[model samples]
Structures are given as structure tokens and as C-alpha cells.
Target: MTDMRVSIAGVKFKNPILVASGTFGFGHEYGKFYDLSELGGICVKGTTLHKRDGNPAPRIAETPSGILNSVGLQNPGVDAFCAEEMPFLKRFDTKIVANISGNTLEEYSELAEKVAAAGVDMIEVNISCPNVKAGGLAFGTSCTSAAAATEAVKNHAGSVPVMVKLSPNVTDITEIARAVEAAGADALSLINTLLGMRIDLKTRRPILKNNTGGLSGPAVLPVAVRMVWQVANAVKLPLLGMGGVASGADAAELMFAGASAVAVGTALFNDPYAPIRVRDELAEYCENAGVARVSELTGGVKPW
Candidate 1:
């Protein structure tokens, strides 16, 4: 059998297919559909220091081949997640990642310390959340803020590796990637949803109540691959590449572009079994291509 194992930072995964945060909802919801242990890992929903009610109604809107969301990091907060959610996910054999975001750097550090103490395998520092302290500018959009956020999480994350998630809405993503890497981030996950909006023709208003949302699904794959390729070459840190990934072929394409691993987000909203399907399909591709190990595909693309 072709080997599908991949190691990110210091955590070893059974495969390279992980469920993107927000879309997987902490694993319990999707566990009802299939064995959660079959995939590489699960990055739970975005959690904050305190509980969030999320944005108003119409938080999610459908587009041609993707969906836009302004869920506003809705969650039961870190305390509840540790006391109530962690035990359930710990039962699975896969790696567990807590995707944490906060309005302030202190909140980010505290949340990282809490989840790290609670024994999550990894912490995904979400700097893409609108910085309330900065009047709504996303932390990931600025090099200084992004590096500061990564340093904050790395400080309190203990033995758990910190993976900084990058926003694609910047002029130069590699600048942010290099900054975070220099700030001691153990890894990076890139191309978080692109900013997008849609209008209702009859009403002449935005479909989402939040006015704009992060777009994901098959539509953003090209952008994701390009960013992954760029960041992968820019920094020595490992990458969890995502955007418009729905199938094993899509996952393979990202790996070829330089993603050490790929996350399935919007696709999971449509197919609960997408993780396994993609995993199987990736293995099939490897076998057909005469590749013995899946890791061989990372940055394997040849320039014309």
C-alpha cells in the first residue's frame, strides 16, 4: 500500500487530509456520518476566549461553485470546549487541533495556554478574525500584527505546535508568512477564505446580513494553490494548504503546488464523507502515478 503519512511541525498525521475549522464543528457532528478516525486529523471550529453568538441571520450564502460565510467565530468558548468537547475528540485516533481566535493579544495568549494545558495536539492561531481592538482590520493582513499574534500563541502553547493561519486578502502573503515564521510559528496554514460579497438583484442588497463573507469551495482552488506555492517557497515552515478543495484530485493538486497537507472545508458542508473520499482518491492517484509515498508529491511540480 502507498504510504499516506505526513508530519507537520512535530505532530505526525495518519494522512494529509484534515477537516478545516468551522466546517467540521469539533468532530461530534460529523462522527455520526462516519468513523472520524479514518482521516488524518480534525481542526475543530473557531473558538474564542468567550462564547460567541456569531453574526446575524443570513450568515451563510450560496454562490455558483462555493459558499460565503460570516459566521463570526461562533463557539462555546475555550472553557466549555476543554471541559465538554475535548474528551469526545480525544477518543478518536486522529490528531486534534483547536482553532483559536481572539480580539486582543492577551486573549489569544490566554486561550492558547488554556487549550494547551487541556492537551490538544496542536493550536491553529487564527489571525484572520477582525481585530476589534484595531477597528476591524484583520490581524493576518499586517506583518507586524500577524507576527505579534504568532509570538503570543507560541509563548503559551507549551509543547503543542502553533500553526498560524494566513489570510489571502493581503498584498503579499509571503511577507506575512515569513514574518510569522520568524516569530516562532511551528507551521502555517494558508489561503483562508477570500473576501467576497453577493447582491440580491431584486432587493439591491447584500445576501449575507454581514454584507461580506469569506468565500470557499471549488472556486478558490487556484488562488489557494498559488499562495501555497508562494508561501511554501518563502518560508521553511510546513504548510496546511486549503481553498476550494473538494476531492482527492483537488487535494493532490494542492500538494503538487507545495502544500504539505490540505484541509477540506466547504466540501465537507456538502459531503460529510469527503475526508475519507479524498484520502482514498489521493492514495489511488499515488498508486497510479507509481509514487510509493504520498509525501513525495509535495512541491513536486515541474516548471515549464
Candidate 2:
């Protein structure tokens, strides 16, 4: 089984490194830089039932080691995705997971149904997107709402694997994790960008149009690892950890912390092919560590 791969929610991924949603931009942008098919899969930009204009300009701000953005899930509607992005993306070899957002439970259920019916390889119920309203975090921060949102979508996700993306803005990630698990999430993606902001000292003003935005980049790596580890322990579902993951070292660290897979976020912004390089590094690391498969690294942490 040296060449065997991992399957999450009945969907097979060629590897364990995926490009996180919002960062990859439908996988086509990165395809210009490298062969994304070399990686495991791609979580596309978040889509709603209708197209979104997103927030105003000055949307992104640079922090010390991280960046804050309130792009506001700016994507063509779910129907447009099926007609446009999907046809082009399906031409690629990698699996496609449609990331979806909605303001209410009914909206979420309807969005999931539309995307699932569109034949995406999988669906990530985007309960934690920081850019939108309906208290996006409100649906993800608590066990009650998290479970309810997950359950609502789960009922209609059909055969497509439904992974609930969790917010890092919560008090206890594990509590939310367990709640979604009980709601029938096939897998979990953790640490959707942490809430943060930046100030332009020179301008004496907040940098972003939205006073605060989600922080993502190398600075968020450690927090992502901790949250992934905590949530992985709390739920039996597979976990995809991301946020501030930029290098092979970061990938290995998260895998060691119990991530079944990892998503490359801001790193994609810097190097469009960062995901491929990280995957290559992981393969070499697995070979060097005398490990037959990268999956062996999951939970291989040493007790402190």
C-alpha cells in the first residue's frame, strides 16, 4: 500500500495537501503558476446562492507577519459556479470541493442542495466565513448553532461529503467541533482566519474598509496547529488544518499535531505553487523519516 491514498467522506484525495478556499480562487489562477493537479484537492472560493459584490475597497491590510482581509466571500453565485467554474475546473484532475456560505439555516440547506446537485466532488459547509453577515461566526462559535447549521446542510448534502469549516474566533473550538460532528459532518476544516485588524500609523486610520478582518499568514500557523490538535481530539471526523501554513516544516508540524490533511492559505498568495512545493517536501520528509506514507505523521507528536 505504499502508493495508497486517503479518503475523506468517501471521496479520495491523491494526497493530503489542499489549497484552502478564498485563497485559491477556483484553482484556475494557480493553474497558471503550476499544475494544481499535482496536489490533493482544491477548496474553491466561497459561493452563495446568488453572486456577491463583497465589501468595499481597502479590503486587505498588511500586518506584521500576517494579513487581514474582508473580501466578504466575493464569488459568483452557486449556479454560476456550476456553469462556469465547474466546467473549467472539472477539466483538471484534482477533486473539487465547493465551499458554500449562507445567512440562515434555510439558505445553507438550499446552497448545499444546489452545489451537491451540481456534482461537486464534495461540499464544505462554510459556517465560519468572516466576511459575511447573518453572524457567520454566530453560526459557528457555539455547539448549538454549529450543530444546527451542520445538521441543516447535512440533511440535503446528498452523496457529496460535507465538511464543516470552523472559526478560530470561538472560545472553545473543540466544543464547536463536537457539535458539528454530532450533526453528521463528514470531516472538519479548522481555524478559519482569526479576527484581527491593522492600523495605518501614517494615515491614522484603520487599514481595511472593514475595521477588522480575518488574519491569515505565517503568524497564524501556531494557532492553527493548536486548534487543529484540539478539534481533532474532540471529534472522530477527519480534520483539515490551515491558517499561516507556508512551508514544508509548517505542514509537517500540523500533520504531527493530528491533521489528517492540511490546507495552504496565505502561502498561496505569496507563491501560487506553494501547495505543490509543500507536498513535495512532505513526500521527501516521509521518505527520510522511514515512513512509508505521510499519513503516519498524524498524531506522531511527542508528549512534552
Candidate 3:
């Protein structure tokens, strides 16, 4: 039998398929569709130090092959998640990854401490959020800010692994990857979301209330694969690749490109069972490819 298990920074996942944060919520809603334990891991919604009302309405819009969203990290805050959501997620056998975002170094450090102490299997730091102290620039956009954020979280994360999520909006993702790695990040997740926008032709105005949003879907797959490959070459840390993964082939492609694991995002909006389907399909692919283990697919691509 092909070995589907993969470990990211010592945290073992039953498989390489994970549901991206903001798409999977806390896994409670998706639990009714299938057995949550059947998959690998779940990156819970982006939580913050305090509850956020999120951006204005009409925060989502359909594009050609994907959707643009400016949800603004709507969440119940870290305290509520630890007190309420964590218990529900612990019931499942799958790994629980707390995806946290903050506006400052202090907030990230505090969030990391609380969630790690609360017993999360991993902490996925969303540095795509703007850094208030850095003139509103995203921490992931600059090596210095990114490294600082990673260092702050690592200082308080205790033993739980800290995985820094990199933004695609930057010019050089590999540079940011190397910075976070040097700052003590145990693993890395890439291609958070590309900056995009939509407009109504007749109205001569933007479609989303926020004017612009992050684009996610099959549209960003190529970019995601490229960034993953580049970062994999640049850093020694394991990578959790995500962007537009919708099928087992897509997952395999990302793995081949360099992802130690993959996450399903916008696909979940259309099919709640996408993660399970991807896992099963990936297993089938490995079996057909005569592969003994799925981990072998990581960084398996050959350059011509």
C-alpha cells in the first residue's frame, strides 16, 4: 500500500490534503458532509486577537475561473476559538492548524502563545495581513518585516510548529521564504492570494464593496506552483502549497513542484467533499504511478 502520511515540521498528517483557512472555517460545518478524520489537516479560519466584523458587504464576486474576496478575516477572535472551537476540532483525529493574523508584532506573539498553549497541532501565521507599524505594508511583502513577524511568533509559540504563510503579491517570494526560515519558522505555506479586482461595466465602478479583493481559484494554480518550486529551492523548511488545488492531479502537480503538502481553498465553496476526493484521487495516482509513497512526489519535478 502507498504511504499517504506526511510530516510537516514533525506534525504528522494522515495525508497531504488539507483544507485552507477561511474556506474550512473550524471544520464543524464540513463535519456533517464527511468524516473529518478521513483527511490530513484543517487550517482553521484566520483568527485574530479580537473579533472582527470584516469588510463591507458584497465582499465576494465571481470571476472567469475563480472568485475574488475581501472578507477581511472575519472571525470570532483567538480567545473564542480556544474556548469554543478548539474543543470541537479536537474530536476529530486530523491535525488542527490554527491560522492566525495580526496587525502588529505583539498581536502575532500573543496569538501564537494562546493557540499553542491551547494545544493546536500547528500554527499557520498569515503575514498577508497589513502591518500597522510598517506604514500599512503587509509583513509578507518585505523580508525584514516577514522575518520579524516570524521571530515574534517563534518566541512565544513554545513547542508547536510555526508555519509562515507567504503572500504572492510580493515581487520575490523566495527572498521572503528565506527570511522566515532564518527567523525560526518551522515550515512555510505559500501563495496566500494574488491581489485582484473586478468592476461592473455599466456602473463604471468596482464590483466588490471593498473595491478590490484577493483572487483565488484555478486561475492562480500556475503562479502557486511556480512560487512553491522557487521557495522549495530557496529554503530547507517544508512547504504547504495552496492556491487553486481542486483535484488529485493538481495536488500531485503541486507536490511535484515542491509542496510537502497541499491545501484546497476556493474548491471547497463548490464541493464540500473536495478534500476527501483529492485525497482519494491522489492515492489512486500514486498507485498508478507505481509510487510506494506519496511523500516521494515532493520536489519530484524534472527540469528539461
What residue pairs are clashing in model 1? 217-244
Model 2 worst lDDT window (10 residues): 1-10
Off by over 4 Å in 2: 1-4
TM-score on alpha carbons, each prediction: 0.97, 0.97, 0.97
Worst 10 residues of 3 by lDDT: 129-138
Q: Provide backbone clash counts, one per model.
A: 1, 1, 0
Residue pairs with backbone overlap in model 3: none
Q: After TM-score superposition, what is the CA distance of residue 245 in candidate 3 from its true location, in Å?
A: 0.4
Residue 116 CA displacement from its true place in model 2, Å: 0.8
| Residue ranges of candidate 3 with Cα displaced over 4 Å | 130-137
lDDT of 2 by residue, 1-304 (tens): 3342566778888998888999888877778878767878899999988899999879998887889999998888989998888888888788888998888889899999988888899899888977777747779878998899898888998888899999998888888888889888999988898888788889888888888899999998999898888877778898887888888789889988888888898987788778988887877777777888777788788857
Error of 1 at 256 (Å): 0.9
Better of 1 and 2 by lDDT: 1
Residue 288 in candidate 1 has what lDDT? Answer: 94
Best lDDT goes to which candidate? Answer: 3
lDDT (Cα, tens digit) per residue for candidate 1, span 119-195: 99999999875412231236888999998999999999989999999988889999999999999999999778888
